[model samples]
Target: MPRTRIHNMNISLDGYAAGEHVTFDAPIGGAERLFDWFDGRVIHGVDRVDAPVTLDRAVISLWSQGIGVEIMGRRKFGPQTGEWPDDGWRGWWGDEPPFHTPVFVMSHYPHPSIDFPNGTSFHFVDAPPHEVLRLAQEAADGRDVRIGGGPSTVRQFLQADLIDFMHLVIVPITLGRGVSLWEGLAGIEDRFTVETVTSPSGLTHQFWNKNGHD
Candidate 1:
Protein backbone atom coordinates (compact mmCIF):
# COMPACT_ATOMS: atom_id res chain seq x y z
CA MET A 1 0.00 0.00 0.00
CA PRO A 2 1.01 3.54 -0.63
CA ARG A 3 2.26 5.33 2.47
CA THR A 4 2.79 8.85 3.78
CA ARG A 5 6.38 9.18 4.93
CA ILE A 6 8.94 11.71 6.18
CA HIS A 7 12.62 11.36 5.46
CA ASN A 8 15.84 12.98 6.64
CA MET A 9 14.20 15.23 9.25
CA ASN A 10 17.08 16.51 11.33
CA ILE A 11 16.42 17.73 14.85
CA SER A 12 18.54 19.00 17.69
CA LEU A 13 18.96 17.24 20.99
CA ASP A 14 16.50 19.73 22.46
CA GLY A 15 13.97 18.65 19.81
CA TYR A 16 14.32 21.69 17.60
CA ALA A 17 14.25 20.92 13.89
CA ALA A 18 15.11 24.30 12.36
CA GLY A 19 16.65 27.54 13.56
CA GLU A 20 14.78 30.64 14.78
CA HIS A 21 14.88 32.63 11.55
CA VAL A 22 14.95 31.54 7.92
CA THR A 23 16.00 34.02 5.31
CA PHE A 24 17.03 34.08 1.66
CA ASP A 25 20.64 34.09 2.77
CA ALA A 26 20.40 31.44 5.50
CA PRO A 27 17.70 28.95 4.65
CA ILE A 28 18.42 26.63 7.55
CA GLY A 29 18.87 29.52 9.94
CA GLY A 30 20.90 28.77 13.09
CA ALA A 31 20.46 25.01 12.85
CA GLU A 32 23.05 24.63 10.10
CA ARG A 33 25.17 22.39 12.29
CA LEU A 34 22.38 19.87 12.48
CA PHE A 35 23.22 18.74 8.94
CA ASP A 36 26.99 18.61 9.34
CA TRP A 37 26.97 14.88 8.75
CA PHE A 38 24.59 14.99 5.82
CA ASP A 39 25.68 14.39 2.22
CA GLY A 40 23.12 15.41 -0.40
CA ARG A 41 24.64 13.07 -2.97
CA VAL A 42 23.64 10.06 -0.90
CA ILE A 43 19.98 10.93 -1.33
CA HIS A 44 20.48 9.94 -4.95
CA GLY A 45 22.34 6.79 -3.90
CA VAL A 46 25.80 8.22 -4.48
CA ASP A 47 28.73 8.06 -2.06
CA ARG A 48 31.48 10.58 -1.60
CA VAL A 49 34.77 10.07 -3.40
CA ASP A 50 37.33 7.90 -1.51
CA ALA A 51 34.65 7.21 1.10
CA PRO A 52 33.38 3.75 1.98
CA VAL A 53 29.71 3.05 2.53
CA THR A 54 28.84 4.15 6.06
CA LEU A 55 25.73 3.44 8.05
CA ASP A 56 24.66 7.08 7.94
CA ARG A 57 24.99 7.32 4.19
CA ALA A 58 23.27 3.99 3.73
CA VAL A 59 20.29 5.22 5.72
CA ILE A 60 20.15 8.66 4.19
CA SER A 61 20.21 7.13 0.73
CA LEU A 62 16.74 5.79 1.35
CA TRP A 63 15.28 9.30 1.27
CA SER A 64 14.05 9.32 -2.33
CA GLN A 65 13.33 5.66 -2.70
CA GLY A 66 9.82 4.97 -3.95
CA ILE A 67 8.68 8.50 -3.22
CA GLY A 68 6.23 9.70 -5.83
CA VAL A 69 5.13 13.03 -4.41
CA GLU A 70 6.09 15.40 -1.59
CA ILE A 71 4.20 17.76 0.73
CA MET A 72 6.09 20.59 2.34
CA GLY A 73 5.41 23.92 4.04
CA ARG A 74 5.97 27.24 2.31
CA ARG A 75 9.15 27.93 4.22
CA LYS A 76 10.70 24.75 2.93
CA PHE A 77 9.90 25.92 -0.58
CA GLY A 78 11.30 29.43 -0.23
CA PRO A 79 11.88 32.33 2.16
CA GLN A 80 8.84 34.26 0.94
CA THR A 81 5.79 34.81 3.13
CA GLY A 82 2.21 36.13 2.82
CA GLU A 83 1.47 37.00 -0.81
CA TRP A 84 4.44 35.93 -2.93
CA PRO A 85 6.33 38.79 -4.52
CA ASP A 86 7.28 38.79 -8.19
CA ASP A 87 10.82 37.77 -7.45
CA GLY A 88 10.70 34.82 -9.89
CA TRP A 89 11.84 32.62 -7.06
CA ARG A 90 11.50 29.03 -8.13
CA GLY A 91 12.87 27.61 -4.89
CA TRP A 92 16.06 27.11 -2.99
CA TRP A 93 17.05 24.50 -5.52
CA GLY A 94 18.51 25.67 -8.76
CA ASP A 95 17.27 24.52 -12.15
CA GLU A 96 16.94 20.93 -10.99
CA PRO A 97 15.61 19.89 -7.58
CA PRO A 98 16.42 16.65 -5.88
CA PHE A 99 12.81 15.65 -5.62
CA HIS A 100 12.07 14.46 -9.16
CA THR A 101 8.39 14.15 -8.44
CA PRO A 102 5.29 16.18 -7.79
CA VAL A 103 5.84 18.50 -4.79
CA PHE A 104 2.89 20.13 -3.09
CA VAL A 105 3.92 23.28 -1.27
CA MET A 106 1.52 24.34 1.49
CA SER A 107 0.71 28.01 1.50
CA HIS A 108 -2.35 30.15 2.24
CA TYR A 109 -1.60 32.39 -0.71
CA PRO A 110 -2.20 30.65 -3.98
CA HIS A 111 0.19 30.76 -6.92
CA PRO A 112 0.47 28.98 -10.21
CA SER A 113 2.39 25.71 -10.21
CA ILE A 114 5.99 25.64 -11.32
CA ASP A 115 7.53 22.81 -13.29
CA PHE A 116 11.15 22.01 -13.84
CA PRO A 117 12.82 20.06 -16.57
CA ASN A 118 14.05 17.44 -14.14
CA GLY A 119 10.50 16.34 -13.36
CA THR A 120 10.28 18.36 -10.16
CA SER A 121 6.96 20.14 -10.24
CA PHE A 122 5.93 22.51 -7.46
CA HIS A 123 2.22 22.87 -6.87
CA PHE A 124 1.07 25.48 -4.40
CA VAL A 125 -1.92 24.64 -2.28
CA ASP A 126 -3.92 26.19 0.54
CA ALA A 127 -5.52 23.54 2.70
CA PRO A 128 -5.25 21.69 5.96
CA PRO A 129 -2.78 18.88 6.48
CA HIS A 130 -5.24 16.08 5.82
CA GLU A 131 -6.63 17.75 2.76
CA VAL A 132 -3.18 18.33 1.35
CA LEU A 133 -2.29 14.74 1.99
CA ARG A 134 -5.32 13.64 0.02
CA LEU A 135 -4.26 15.75 -2.94
CA ALA A 136 -0.71 14.45 -2.67
CA GLN A 137 -1.84 10.86 -2.48
CA GLU A 138 -3.92 11.30 -5.55
CA ALA A 139 -0.97 12.79 -7.39
CA ALA A 140 1.27 10.02 -6.09
CA ASP A 141 -0.42 7.54 -8.43
CA GLY A 142 0.02 4.59 -6.03
CA ARG A 143 3.54 5.48 -4.92
CA ASP A 144 4.36 6.77 -1.46
CA VAL A 145 3.98 10.45 -0.53
CA ARG A 146 6.87 12.07 1.31
CA ILE A 147 6.36 14.82 3.87
CA GLY A 148 9.14 17.32 3.11
CA GLY A 149 9.17 19.49 6.16
CA GLY A 150 10.87 22.20 8.19
CA PRO A 151 9.43 21.08 11.55
CA SER A 152 6.13 22.93 11.42
CA THR A 153 4.84 20.93 8.47
CA VAL A 154 5.88 17.60 9.92
CA ARG A 155 4.35 18.49 13.29
CA GLN A 156 1.04 19.22 11.64
CA PHE A 157 0.98 15.81 9.93
CA LEU A 158 2.03 14.05 13.11
CA GLN A 159 -0.67 15.86 15.07
CA ALA A 160 -3.24 14.75 12.54
CA ASP A 161 -1.95 11.16 12.66
CA LEU A 162 -1.44 11.17 8.91
CA ILE A 163 2.16 10.00 8.73
CA ASP A 164 2.82 6.31 8.15
CA PHE A 165 6.62 6.24 8.30
CA MET A 166 9.32 8.65 9.34
CA HIS A 167 13.13 8.75 9.31
CA LEU A 168 14.17 11.27 11.97
CA VAL A 169 17.82 12.18 12.45
CA ILE A 170 18.57 13.50 15.92
CA VAL A 171 21.73 15.53 16.21
CA PRO A 172 23.48 16.12 19.53
CA ILE A 173 23.13 19.86 19.91
CA THR A 174 20.93 22.50 21.48
CA LEU A 175 19.45 25.33 19.46
CA GLY A 176 18.07 27.01 22.62
CA ARG A 177 15.47 28.80 20.53
CA GLY A 178 14.19 27.68 17.16
CA VAL A 179 11.42 25.75 15.46
CA SER A 180 10.78 22.56 17.45
CA LEU A 181 9.57 19.25 16.09
CA TRP A 182 8.28 17.63 19.26
CA GLU A 183 6.37 20.60 20.61
CA GLY A 184 2.82 19.65 21.60
CA LEU A 185 3.51 16.17 20.34
CA ALA A 186 3.37 14.43 23.68
CA GLY A 187 3.35 10.64 23.61
CA ILE A 188 3.68 10.49 19.84
CA GLU A 189 5.82 7.40 20.09
CA ASP A 190 2.91 5.34 21.30
CA ARG A 191 1.35 5.35 17.86
CA PHE A 192 4.41 4.11 16.04
CA THR A 193 6.91 1.29 16.35
CA VAL A 194 10.09 3.18 17.01
CA GLU A 195 13.65 2.03 16.47
CA THR A 196 16.97 3.81 16.69
CA VAL A 197 20.40 3.34 15.17
CA THR A 198 23.28 5.45 16.35
CA SER A 199 26.00 6.24 13.87
CA PRO A 200 29.63 6.71 14.81
CA SER A 201 29.27 10.33 13.68
CA GLY A 202 26.93 10.94 16.66
CA LEU A 203 23.79 11.08 14.57
CA THR A 204 20.93 8.94 15.82
CA HIS A 205 18.55 7.84 13.09
CA GLN A 206 15.10 7.08 14.42
CA PHE A 207 12.64 5.14 12.32
CA TRP A 208 9.01 5.46 13.22
CA ASN A 209 6.40 3.27 11.56
CA LYS A 210 2.76 3.61 12.42
CA ASN A 211 1.26 0.63 14.19
CA GLY A 212 0.00 -2.09 11.83
CA HIS A 213 1.77 -0.46 8.90
CA ASP A 214 4.41 -2.15 6.86
Candidate 2:
Protein backbone atom coordinates (compact mmCIF):
# COMPACT_ATOMS: atom_id res chain seq x y z
CA MET A 1 0.00 0.00 0.00
CA PRO A 2 1.14 3.52 -0.72
CA ARG A 3 1.39 5.87 2.23
CA THR A 4 2.20 9.52 2.83
CA ARG A 5 3.61 11.27 5.86
CA ILE A 6 1.25 14.07 6.83
CA HIS A 7 3.30 16.13 9.24
CA ASN A 8 3.77 19.77 10.15
CA MET A 9 6.45 22.02 8.73
CA ASN A 10 6.05 24.07 11.91
CA ILE A 11 4.75 22.55 15.10
CA SER A 12 2.93 23.47 18.29
CA LEU A 13 0.85 21.92 21.04
CA ASP A 14 -2.43 20.06 21.51
CA GLY A 15 -4.10 23.44 21.86
CA TYR A 16 -2.95 24.50 18.42
CA ALA A 17 -3.74 21.09 16.99
CA ALA A 18 -7.00 21.27 18.86
CA GLY A 19 -7.67 25.00 18.73
CA GLU A 20 -10.04 27.35 16.84
CA HIS A 21 -8.13 29.80 14.65
CA VAL A 22 -4.51 29.32 13.51
CA THR A 23 -2.95 32.62 12.52
CA PHE A 24 0.64 33.80 12.15
CA ASP A 25 0.80 35.53 15.52
CA ALA A 26 -1.01 32.58 17.03
CA PRO A 27 0.42 29.75 15.02
CA ILE A 28 0.66 27.25 17.81
CA GLY A 29 -2.02 27.73 20.46
CA GLY A 30 -1.84 26.37 23.94
CA ALA A 31 1.60 25.16 23.07
CA GLU A 32 3.10 26.48 26.26
CA ARG A 33 0.97 23.90 28.01
CA LEU A 34 2.86 21.25 26.13
CA PHE A 35 6.32 21.59 27.63
CA ASP A 36 5.73 17.96 28.45
CA TRP A 37 5.68 17.09 24.76
CA PHE A 38 8.62 18.70 22.82
CA ASP A 39 11.37 16.94 24.77
CA GLY A 40 12.27 20.36 26.26
CA ARG A 41 13.48 22.13 23.13
CA VAL A 42 11.07 25.05 23.47
CA ILE A 43 12.69 27.60 21.15
CA HIS A 44 15.42 28.70 23.49
CA GLY A 45 18.71 29.91 21.96
CA VAL A 46 20.59 27.99 24.61
CA ASP A 47 22.74 25.27 23.15
CA ARG A 48 23.67 22.11 25.00
CA VAL A 49 25.90 19.39 23.58
CA ASP A 50 24.25 16.56 25.42
CA ALA A 51 20.83 18.17 24.90
CA PRO A 52 18.78 17.65 21.75
CA VAL A 53 16.18 20.15 20.54
CA THR A 54 14.53 19.50 23.91
CA LEU A 55 11.50 20.10 21.76
CA ASP A 56 10.67 16.82 20.06
CA ARG A 57 14.11 16.85 18.47
CA ALA A 58 13.49 13.31 17.30
CA VAL A 59 10.41 14.28 15.30
CA ILE A 60 12.03 17.42 13.96
CA SER A 61 15.01 15.53 12.67
CA LEU A 62 12.72 13.00 11.05
CA TRP A 63 10.85 15.82 9.33
CA SER A 64 14.04 17.41 8.09
CA GLN A 65 15.54 14.26 6.61
CA GLY A 66 12.73 11.79 5.94
CA ILE A 67 10.77 13.11 2.98
CA GLY A 68 11.44 13.95 -0.65
CA VAL A 69 8.45 15.94 -1.90
CA GLU A 70 6.34 18.36 0.14
CA ILE A 71 2.97 20.03 -0.32
CA MET A 72 2.07 23.28 1.43
CA GLY A 73 -0.59 25.95 1.42
CA ARG A 74 0.34 29.43 0.27
CA ARG A 75 -0.44 30.91 3.65
CA LYS A 76 2.06 28.53 5.25
CA PHE A 77 4.64 29.45 2.65
CA GLY A 78 4.36 33.25 2.83
CA PRO A 79 4.42 35.68 5.64
CA GLN A 80 1.86 34.54 8.18
CA THR A 81 1.79 38.30 8.89
CA GLY A 82 0.18 39.83 5.74
CA GLU A 83 -1.39 39.36 2.36
CA TRP A 84 0.73 38.44 -0.64
CA PRO A 85 0.70 40.79 -3.64
CA ASP A 86 1.98 38.58 -6.42
CA ASP A 87 3.55 35.24 -7.36
CA GLY A 88 6.98 36.79 -7.42
CA TRP A 89 7.29 36.20 -3.67
CA ARG A 90 9.14 33.11 -2.57
CA GLY A 91 8.98 31.55 0.88
CA TRP A 92 10.36 33.25 3.99
CA TRP A 93 12.95 30.51 4.62
CA GLY A 94 15.57 32.57 2.71
CA ASP A 95 18.01 31.52 -0.05
CA GLU A 96 19.05 28.06 1.08
CA PRO A 97 16.00 26.47 2.60
CA PRO A 98 16.20 23.02 4.12
CA PHE A 99 13.82 21.70 1.51
CA HIS A 100 15.65 20.73 -1.69
CA THR A 101 12.97 18.63 -3.37
CA PRO A 102 9.90 19.55 -5.38
CA VAL A 103 7.33 21.53 -3.38
CA PHE A 104 3.74 21.89 -4.47
CA VAL A 105 1.93 24.96 -3.21
CA MET A 106 -1.83 25.32 -3.19
CA SER A 107 -3.21 28.76 -3.97
CA HIS A 108 -6.15 30.52 -5.62
CA TYR A 109 -4.28 33.53 -6.92
CA PRO A 110 -2.53 32.78 -10.20
CA HIS A 111 1.09 33.72 -9.90
CA PRO A 112 4.12 33.08 -12.03
CA SER A 113 6.30 30.06 -11.36
CA ILE A 114 9.47 30.15 -9.27
CA ASP A 115 12.76 28.23 -9.26
CA PHE A 116 14.96 28.46 -6.19
CA PRO A 117 18.73 28.07 -6.20
CA ASN A 118 18.78 25.46 -3.46
CA GLY A 119 17.65 22.70 -5.83
CA THR A 120 14.10 23.35 -4.65
CA SER A 121 11.50 23.84 -7.36
CA PHE A 122 8.18 25.46 -6.48
CA HIS A 123 5.03 24.74 -8.44
CA PHE A 124 1.60 26.26 -8.01
CA VAL A 125 -1.46 24.16 -8.72
CA ASP A 126 -5.13 25.04 -8.93
CA ALA A 127 -6.09 21.41 -9.31
CA PRO A 128 -8.21 19.54 -6.82
CA PRO A 129 -6.51 18.51 -3.58
CA HIS A 130 -6.33 14.84 -4.54
CA GLU A 131 -4.87 15.74 -7.90
CA VAL A 132 -2.26 17.85 -6.23
CA LEU A 133 -1.38 14.98 -3.92
CA ARG A 134 -1.15 12.63 -6.84
CA LEU A 135 1.26 14.90 -8.67
CA ALA A 136 3.36 15.38 -5.59
CA GLN A 137 3.41 11.67 -4.93
CA GLU A 138 4.60 11.05 -8.44
CA ALA A 139 7.33 13.62 -8.09
CA ALA A 140 8.43 12.01 -4.87
CA ASP A 141 9.30 8.70 -6.57
CA GLY A 142 10.19 6.22 -3.82
CA ARG A 143 10.50 8.61 -0.93
CA ASP A 144 7.38 9.65 0.96
CA VAL A 145 5.62 12.89 0.09
CA ARG A 146 5.12 14.94 3.20
CA ILE A 147 1.97 16.98 3.62
CA GLY A 148 3.31 20.26 4.98
CA GLY A 149 0.40 22.31 6.17
CA GLY A 150 -1.14 25.18 7.97
CA PRO A 151 -4.19 24.20 10.04
CA SER A 152 -6.65 24.89 7.23
CA THR A 153 -4.81 22.81 4.70
CA VAL A 154 -4.47 19.87 7.06
CA ARG A 155 -8.16 20.13 7.88
CA GLN A 156 -9.05 20.02 4.21
CA PHE A 157 -6.98 16.91 3.60
CA LEU A 158 -8.18 15.26 6.78
CA GLN A 159 -11.78 15.89 5.77
CA ALA A 160 -11.03 14.20 2.49
CA ASP A 161 -9.50 11.23 4.37
CA LEU A 162 -6.24 11.52 2.49
CA ILE A 163 -3.72 11.36 5.32
CA ASP A 164 -2.03 8.08 6.15
CA PHE A 165 0.13 8.63 9.21
CA MET A 166 1.19 11.50 11.42
CA HIS A 167 3.50 12.18 14.33
CA LEU A 168 2.16 14.90 16.61
CA VAL A 169 4.65 16.42 19.06
CA ILE A 170 2.71 18.68 21.36
CA VAL A 171 4.85 21.63 22.41
CA PRO A 172 4.08 23.18 25.77
CA ILE A 173 2.86 26.67 24.96
CA THR A 174 -0.36 28.54 24.38
CA LEU A 175 -1.21 31.21 21.86
CA GLY A 176 -4.54 31.61 23.70
CA ARG A 177 -6.19 32.12 20.28
CA GLY A 178 -5.23 30.84 16.85
CA VAL A 179 -5.93 28.27 14.12
CA SER A 180 -7.12 24.77 14.94
CA LEU A 181 -6.92 21.37 13.28
CA TRP A 182 -10.56 21.19 12.32
CA GLU A 183 -13.70 23.22 12.62
CA GLY A 184 -16.14 20.31 12.37
CA LEU A 185 -13.98 17.27 12.73
CA ALA A 186 -16.23 16.32 15.64
CA GLY A 187 -13.82 13.57 16.58
CA ILE A 188 -11.05 11.36 15.24
CA GLU A 189 -11.98 8.33 17.30
CA ASP A 190 -12.63 6.17 14.26
CA ARG A 191 -10.17 7.73 11.86
CA PHE A 192 -6.75 7.31 13.41
CA THR A 193 -5.10 4.61 15.49
CA VAL A 194 -2.33 5.29 17.95
CA GLU A 195 0.74 3.31 17.09
CA THR A 196 3.32 4.44 19.63
CA VAL A 197 4.07 7.19 22.09
CA THR A 198 7.21 8.61 23.72
CA SER A 199 7.36 11.15 26.53
CA PRO A 200 9.91 13.91 27.07
CA SER A 201 10.06 17.57 28.09
CA GLY A 202 6.54 17.38 29.44
CA LEU A 203 5.66 16.60 25.84
CA THR A 204 4.42 13.35 24.30
CA HIS A 205 5.04 12.35 20.72
CA GLN A 206 1.83 10.75 19.48
CA PHE A 207 2.24 8.52 16.49
CA TRP A 208 -0.91 7.76 14.56
CA ASN A 209 -1.80 5.67 11.56
CA LYS A 210 -4.95 5.71 9.47
CA ASN A 211 -7.85 3.52 10.43
CA GLY A 212 -8.14 -0.26 9.91
CA HIS A 213 -4.44 -0.84 9.14
CA ASP A 214 -1.00 0.66 8.99
Per-model TM-score, in order, reads 0.95, 0.76
- lDDT of every model, 2 decimals: 0.89, 0.64
lDDT of 1 by residue, 1-214 (tens): 9999998899988888998788988788777888876754536664532377778887888888898999999999988878999899999989979899999999999899999999999999999999999999999999999998989999999999999999999988887989999999999999999999899989999999999865
- Evaluate model 2: give its lDDT: 0.64
RMSD of 1: 1.5
Write down the TM-score for model 2. 0.76
What's the count of clashing pairs in each model shown?
0, 31
Model 1, residue pairs in steric clash: none
Position 71, candidate 1: lDDT: 94
- The global Cα lDDT (0 to 1) of model 1 is 0.89
- For model 2, how does the per-residue alpha-carbon lDDT over 118-174 read when each residue is reduced to its tens digit? 778888787777998899888888778778776678778878888888776555565
